[model samples]
Target: MTRILVVGATGLVGREIVRKALRDDRITRLIAPTRRPLEPHPKLHNPLVDFDRLPEDAGWWAVNSVICVLGTTRAKAGSDQAFRKVDYDYPLAVARLAHRHGAMRFALNSSLGAAAAPRLLYSRTKGEIEAAITAVGFSSLTIVRPGLIGGDRNEFRAGEWIAARVLGALGPLLPRRFRISPAPKIADALVEAAIAGASGVHLIEADQLAAD
Candidate 1:
């Protein structure tokens, strides 16, 4: 049985993860901290919290694994600095705290183009977080990088909507790496990685998320 903490429980991919994890027998408990409440589940401990001011010493931090899908677009954040705080800082903070509390597994939801080298602010921030989290020293670390995610989102993203349309029309014509990654698939990968607690660092890329 695994006790797992899921950050970003309200987001698109995060929602999928929570749904699956609650139904998974391997998970004995799920601790999710969100700005708002989630539907009550017997196995879930939902804590309403501000990510900027998380309770560092809370007992809920004592989990076997952590899945961090927290992210926000620059447009939604209203500035690049704000975006970094969400996509980079918050996730890293959660990782460090979880590790400190004896969590041995970590799974991160990243983007397709994330890299440490200079590039788009979004990609750079993702890369930096990946690096920062790695330093947290979880025995099992999994990073999943998916392409344009496809799912019904609670909020509208004009850019992703337009891109999804274009990519949907292309479909199988595009390489697997460029195809739209289903939100549920990404969530499944994160949950499985956390539960399995496989040793060493593993990278699950866009192509791997697709069904054969």
Candidate 2:
């Protein structure tokens, strides 16, 4: 019976991860905190939390592993700073709290081409967040760098929707690394990584994530 903490449970990838984890026999309980409330579940405890200001309760951090699929685009977030707050700050804060509350493993849903050296602001921010979480000294850390995620999303992002449709049509022509990754696949990988009990840091690229 493993207790898990999931952030951003309202998003596309996050929602799938939550659904999958609930069905897993290995998981005893799931503590999912988001800005909005989710449907009630027997194995889930959903708490509405503000990303800019997390609750001070230390009990919220008690879990076996922390899975973060939290992210937002500039258009939705309104500005670069707002996007960074969701993509970088919120996840890092959750990781820190999880570490303090005795969680051992952390699985992050980072984007492709996330590098500290990159000129792109989004990439740089993601890379920085990855580095920060790694430095938190978790017993095991799994960083998944997925390409364009293909799934029914909650929010309306025209660019992503168009990309998914176009890429889906040209699936065979697209490179394996750039292929649209199903949310279910990524969710399965995250759960598997936690169940495997692998130690140290692991970087799962797009191809490997898709295969999983």
- In terms of TM-score, the best-performing candidate is 1
Instruction: Quantify all predictions' global Cα lDDT against the true fold.
Output: 0.92, 0.86
Expressed as tens digits, the lDDT of each residue in 1-212 for candidate 2 is: 78999997888888888889889999999999988888999999988887778885658689999999988888878998999999999998999888988999999999888994578888999899999999999999999898899887767778888988887888878778888888888888887776665899998889875522
Identify the runs in model 2 with alpha carbons over 4 angstroms from their true place: none
lDDT of 2 at 147: 87
lDDT score, candidate 2, position 19: 86
Candidate 1 lDDT tens digits, 1-212: 99999999999999999999999999999999999999999999999998889899999999999999999999899999999999998999899999999999999999898884557898889889888998889999999999999999988888999999998988889889899999999999999999995899999999987533
Worst 10 residues of 2 by lDDT: 203-212
